[model samples]
Target: MRLHRSLLTAAAVSGLLLVTACGSADPAGDGTSGGLNPPPLKAPTALGSPEGQVNLIAWAGYVEDGSNDPKVDWVSGFEKQTGCQVNAKTAATSDEMVALMKTGAYDAVSASGDASLRLIASGDAAPVNTALVPHYADVFAGLKNQEWNSVKGVAYGIPHGRGANLLMYDTAKVTPAPDSWSAVFDGASAHSGKVTAYDSPIYIADAALYLSATKPELGIKNPYALDKKQFDASVALLKAQNEHVGEYWSDYLKEISAFKSGDSAIGTSWQVIANLAKAEGAKVEAVLPKEGATGWSDTWMVSAKAKHPTCAYKWLDWIVSPKANAQVAEYFGEAPANARSCAETAAKDHCATFHASDEEYWKKVRFWTTPIEQCLDGRTDVRCVPYASWVQAWNEIKG
Candidate 1:
């Protein structure tokens, strides 16, 4: 059994992550320049320097300072140095992000684990030449070698932010924290009406994770890529979890608001939310089950067809530098992709809180990878399932 959306994430910090203006906000009007297509931006020289004006898409809190006050805005610092203007949009989901990127106007994107591979595969992004980015050498090695964004062994982007999929609960209510997903799937009789999960196509992985734990016979290495038997088992588990969920959320702010307002009590979440709740004096704790957890890592990708390749690359380099990555991590609440960023964080233990620099800890952390037509590990006869299955299953479960 698995709680649906709200209980899964109660998370959007990774939503439309590294959300570069991949598509239009409205999704209605053709974001295209010519009448026929969503405008392919000329890679406007609108921006001037890596430190100056930049157009970026990111999640909430990634760019806020409690004051809509521009002075505190991180991008504002960039704008002051270069004559370039800054245009930023905050997206909450990856699909929304991919659509936005079609415009080709955005300078850079913080692509999530699930979407990064897709962007690279679809030819929407260009390979990152690490030589241009000084801090690239300081990133975690395991991250650099992931299966998703790396194709034929070349990296398509730079590492940015990261987090683990964990169970966040109201410790004030439950006696023993949910050690496994079963608590939520069983609808923990102790906490029924208050359960929540995430609402997104990517969340199918949550079910796959639980199934993998319970049914190892299926040989499912990646949740995003499930065989028919594995897929069926996972869906059955989600269907069972469906009964307990109170909401299927796609917004992080709403999840926090719900927890704060008493609409929710227990659910799955990331380290960021749990810590924030702690800061607010809420009775909450983030639990990493003995069974391990699912997690996400994001990358910085440039548009392959970009009109401003030079400017786009400059921005990517500057942003991934230790200092800039630290600022992004602190503001966003995810682990920094660049290892050196740890020393640059403004908050105490910011790196430690997110477990940014601990290579040993990171070594044990399993990350999400993109699912291709062939089995993830290249199983030939098995006819390994693909990510499309998860997308379909997610729709059915949400429905």
Candidate 2:
């Protein structure tokens, strides 16, 4: 299933969402920017007794407790080992995750890149003390200390897993094979009323990414960081593509059904969905387009207002432990963040199948990120579009 399950409704709460840079300002001062100076907060210096309970807001399939499938229970083991009774709520969207975190009811969240920066900037998520998480030592180097889950070199969360939004099409339907996103964009009219797209504001980045390669004159260095002109162009492209869209889907099952039923001949999809569709006798194939793709690397972040800090920390450590990481990653259909997990998966080639350790493969994937006024690409001249604008634009495009 896809990490985010429900369609995004409105954008975000007005002006509170703003993501800054990945690190401190450059000494040269060449139109670059720095990370946000979050409100005064500090991670716990030492572990305490378990709080006996930990609340979590996670993506579906992330906090499985054997209720869905008897064989897929990672939470049970953690609860037994740490004395932290697991209480998990599955979030449907990044916006919902952010809203849930703000209530201070949950101790932690499995946040995607688009929501991580917003949590960090809003002081809803706390800085993670890696020393408290023993499994942190085994996480892939490529997954650590990135712009989405960190600021100024301080870690904010534990990397959970990663996957790309791929192009999936019926092998029997799409001829000559496909290698680019144009199958859903510029060439979309050819598949009019058959092309599909993810139903969220973040999908706008996919359009921006396509334009980044097709129209270099726009100077779209980063899909998430778009100035006025660039943002308008991307919006325009989507508005045009919307005319041909068969349907916009947020639920993976719906997408899989669409492909199997031939309602959707071509569209953006996840590796998991394609696998399931084909396993069910759908003649489909999924691939990373040559133009690259918008993907997600989820992070397990603790709430700043966590009432069960010790248990939250324990849950963080347990989730990324080799065995648990492997279990969740396999179930969720993504590359595990823990390098040691490669040895734990039931499928001998699970790691290889998902490119778990392939840094070069991931280089072609632009993980989803929050769009803010300050350009994430470090352009300081003009204000870049924020996520709220994307949300508003998305509504109009769909209209």
Candidate 3:
């Protein structure tokens, strides 16, 4: 589920950015220079004294100031150590984060794949100077310089955390324990009107990934890179699953409550949500389906026009430091970006539970990314549908 609702104006905002970027031409037919490449926004020269206050836009629970749960706080510790008072605003979805970043009111944001590239393209996010973040070197190597967080070897943001979306079921309700995505796709009708799904366009990748295994002829190498035919097949599968959906969920607490109340018997879920559901006395189990699943690796990005650049850099370093990273990772239910945090987790086996460094396990989980007209799978013969199409298709599927 999306942590927040995407702005209804995402398509409009993205379209405007795309058109404006494409219109600028230094015109010697420089294929090497422009179009779709993120602007080379400069990184900070050096860290300076704390500005005393730093505002952040983040997903729910990412930057906790302790109001939710006193024991779950990391922000207060950072503030106390660095002298930068944290003023955080929780964003429900990537689109909402993008819109908020454009306002230039916040110093930093926790951006997902879908919004990170857009922020970089619109010049709303600056290229990060990794040197400024001392702990960045300790971040998991698998998370660094990937397609979503970096452009041509230039880092854009500091990796926050990563996790796969597993299929969660009420153990008492779903018999035989599902190992494949078919339990929620081709076989969703078995739990008709009791099945749920995440409420975001990015979820379309889950359908595409399922099809990559079930329908090899579709040539769906990368779930995010879909040609017209591949896109149609994925959308069709989602439409079919929609027929059995109890409800589409966005918030963690909502899905946890649904599972606890038995309103939803089977659906897509995060590792944290499943843990929370079980803690609330719900008889539930979660597993990564045999066909694998879609996941996300979030990044903590500084605003291009940050009012407190030095404080923003300090905040970035503070969050990824071992102690703080451990606290946030355990709380958020994701693998810590900092490898050093693994030993610091409250649960002795937390790292093992999430397969934090199991390269083989991660090889099967496709991380979320922003789809563009250019196919991410390196295909050029067929035009791939961009994220805008997925957003529009999601609206239709829900209807």
TM-score of candidate 3 relative to the true fold: 0.90
Give TM-scores for every candidate, taking all chains together and pairing residue i with residue i.
Answer: 0.80, 0.95, 0.90
Best by lDDT: 2
Question: 139-220 in candidate 2: lDDT tens per residue?
Answer: 9987887778877667889999999899999888888689999989999988899999999898999999999999999999
User: Which of candidates 1 and 2 is the stronger one according to lDDT?
Assistant: 2
What are the per-residue Cα lDDT tens digits for candidate 1 across 1-399? 001112212233222222112211111111121101112222232333343445666555454433564434555554454444556677665655566676776766767766665566555776667776667888877577465555544567777777887888887677677777767775455577688887765566677777677778877666655667877887887776776778877566677777877777887787878777777777888777655667777777777666555556666666677876787777667888778888887786888877776766654345666444444543445444455555666767867
Candidate order, lDDT descending: 2, 3, 1
Stretches of candidate 2 exceeding 4 Å from the true structure? 1-4, 19-35
**Candidates' C-alpha lDDT:** 0.62, 0.86, 0.82
- TM-score: which is higher, 1 or 3? 3
For model 2, what is the alpha-carbon lDDT of residue 223?
89
User: With candidate 3 superimposed using the best TM-score fit, by how many Å does residue 108's alpha carbon deviate from the native?
Assistant: 1.0
